[model samples]
Target: MGTQERLDPQAGVGTRVREPWVTVVWNDPVNLMSYVTRVFQEYFGLARHEAEARMREVHEKGRSVLSSGSREQMEIHVQAMHGYGLWATLERSDG
Candidate 1:
């Protein structure tokens, strides 16, 4: 067994590392599509079309990445999303 393999067999050698944080909004039964779009616009200041697209993504795909940035900013976004009564979480991009 090689030294690299001995350290951790699960991780392949020379793995690319990405540490960006992302704020994800999950779909739920309560919020309407239009309301979600409006919330995105109001909170993130996204244009109508962009907000609509994100809202649709959440509606259809069950989740949408609302924003990506530093961990502090992502945490703020997650809290704001919670304030709006939306389900949300933060995760590393490389997941």
Candidate 2:
């Protein structure tokens, strides 16, 4: 199966549905786990437990999906993460 396409009523043309984009934070050697968790909490407004879980995922799995939304929002998130000294990237969601 594949993603569904939709017709834009106004434009009267077919367009692929917009897929959500995700901001991914990658593990790095420089930042401490505690710091990463704190950043996740502060920037993403995530609960303490949730932030800690994501931090652990980045530590063990090499990366973690921090947020999912429009591509522009994900870009903003990636930029914020860079400002905070965390490695991050954005990509289309698999779903």
Candidate 3:
């Protein structure tokens, strides 16, 4: 066996190392799309069109990344989303 391989078989292999956490806003039966859009605009400072686009993405795609960062930040976003009566969660990306 080569010296490089002896260190550990996985060590020499390339892999994506960044941790990606996302604040996912889910589709809900109660909140209106317009309200969701407004909340996104208010919290994220996104324009009306941008907010609406994101909302539509959530409705069609089942979820949208409302924010992304460290676990702490994602938690805050998820909590805020809940306060607005929207379903949200934080998940670490598998990639």
Which candidate's TM-score is highest?
2
> Could you say which candidate leads in lDDT?
2
For residues 1-95, what per-residue lDDT tens digits would candidate 2 score against the true structure?
Answer: 12347898999999987556899999999999999999999999999999999999999999999888778788999999999999999988886
lDDT against the true structure, each candidate: 0.86, 0.91, 0.83
lDDT of 1 by residue, 1-95 (tens): 00121333576455433447899999999998999999999999999999999999999999999888778889999999999999999988864
Residue 21 shift from truth in candidate 2, angstroms: 0.8
The TM-score values for the models, in the order shown, are 0.78, 0.83, 0.78
**Higher-ranked by TM-score: 1 or 2:** 2
Rank ordering of all candidates by TM-score, starting from the highest: 2, 1, 3
Per-residue lDDT for 1-95 in model 3, tens only?
A: 00111333557764433446888999988899999999999998999999999999989989898777767778898999999899999998654
List runs of model 1 lying over 4 Å from the truth. 1-19
RMSD of each: 7.3, 4.5, 7.3
For candidate 2, list the clashing residue pairs, or say none.
none
Model 3: residues >4 Å from true position, as ranges?
1-17
Error of 3 at 83 (Å): 0.6
Model 3, total clashes: 0
Clashes of each: 0, 0, 0
